[model samples]
Target: MAFKPQSDSDGALSEINVTPLVDVMLVLVIILLVTAPLLTQSVHVTLPKTASTSANIDAQPLQLGIDALGVITLNKQPVINLLALEATLKAEFTKNKDVGVHLYADQAVVYKKVAEVMATVQQAGIAKMAFVTVEE
Candidate 1:
């Protein structure tokens, strides 16, 4: 590169020297294009197919929880009363007949509260119910 002062008759440079910037940008674009396909290369996978579709994929399970204070929740949303819980359950069942409810009751919660909630779930015509438990 040679040092050369560029100026007009007024001794002021009027135009910017953007040739180097354009060259650098073009080089970067070429590098990206060459490496893009290599970055996207992934192993070909053949996933095993099962006879029955997973419930988690088909429909999300509704979560029902009863705290030690006997407060009820459906899908983590608070329910004011058994009637409200029942209504929500009915709506869920109507939306997807195969939808299941996973009930989690705090150990300190009274059995009566849990029973009442179960009865209300039954009344809502939900046949598929599972008790969620922790491992050890």
Candidate 2:
């Protein structure tokens, strides 16, 4: 008579061999979970531009405003005249690349005044231009 184990007499797999597969799947799941956020992460910021739908896309914008008194304001700082304004703008564009300037003229301001400001901005090598207007 040969000696035999009692559990093997049933001729069935009493223990499962799934630990390796489970470990590999768990490792893959952990790797995906760790890297999911990084895959879609990005930086969001607004450089500046016009509200007009007709205006072209711009990356950076400089604000130029003329009040009812015909005073020129660059980014809200008052300037004496177009020459000083041009010098200041040129210096600004030198530091920032691909510059766009937006002109906000008061409704009471003359068309010639707005044109003059645009002229200076153009001379300073600022390529893009836009006009600011109220909706009403």
Candidate 3:
């Protein structure tokens, strides 16, 4: 038995026909070529250059948050007052001298309350502290 085309003629067509496949593939390639440029067009921007500062900090940072009610929290756990906040920071700093603190204050909270928290953190000897702000 020989492989043969099922057609009106009984004889086999020996040549492998790839013309239709090649035509379909070429059409796909052309479609991709037409749309690729549109997909990759982007806004050109002039970005400012700055000297990169080396960050030597390797310890996990503690988060201190003051919500709108003037309530304070140390790493999400509620602290009674600034004295408690200072105690928490002091204990954490004792474990890792380079421990950093990130402060998050709600927009409705008073600046004096935030400042009091900062002073407490400073008194705790935590030198690495930064105010966390949300971008518009």
lDDT of each: 0.91, 0.87, 0.91
Residue-wise C-alpha lDDT for candidate 2, range 23-131, written one tens digit per residue: 9999999999999989999889887986867644644588899989899999889998889999998998898757788888898999999889889998998887888
Residue range 45-90, candidate 3, lDDT tens digits: 9999999998765667999999999999988999998887888889
The C-alpha TM-scores of every prediction are: 0.58, 0.55, 0.57
Candidate 3, superposed: residue stretches over 4 Å from native: 1-58
Q: Write the per-residue lDDT of candidate 1 for residues 1-136, one digit (tens) a residue.
A: 9977665665666899999999999999999999999999999999999798554586988999999999999878899999999988899889988888899999999999999999999999998999988999
State which candidate, 1 or 2, has the greater lDDT: 1
> What's the C-alpha lDDT at position 29 in model 2?
100
Query: Which residue pairs show collisions in model 1?
Result: none
lDDT score, candidate 1: 0.91
Ranking by TM-score: 1, 3, 2
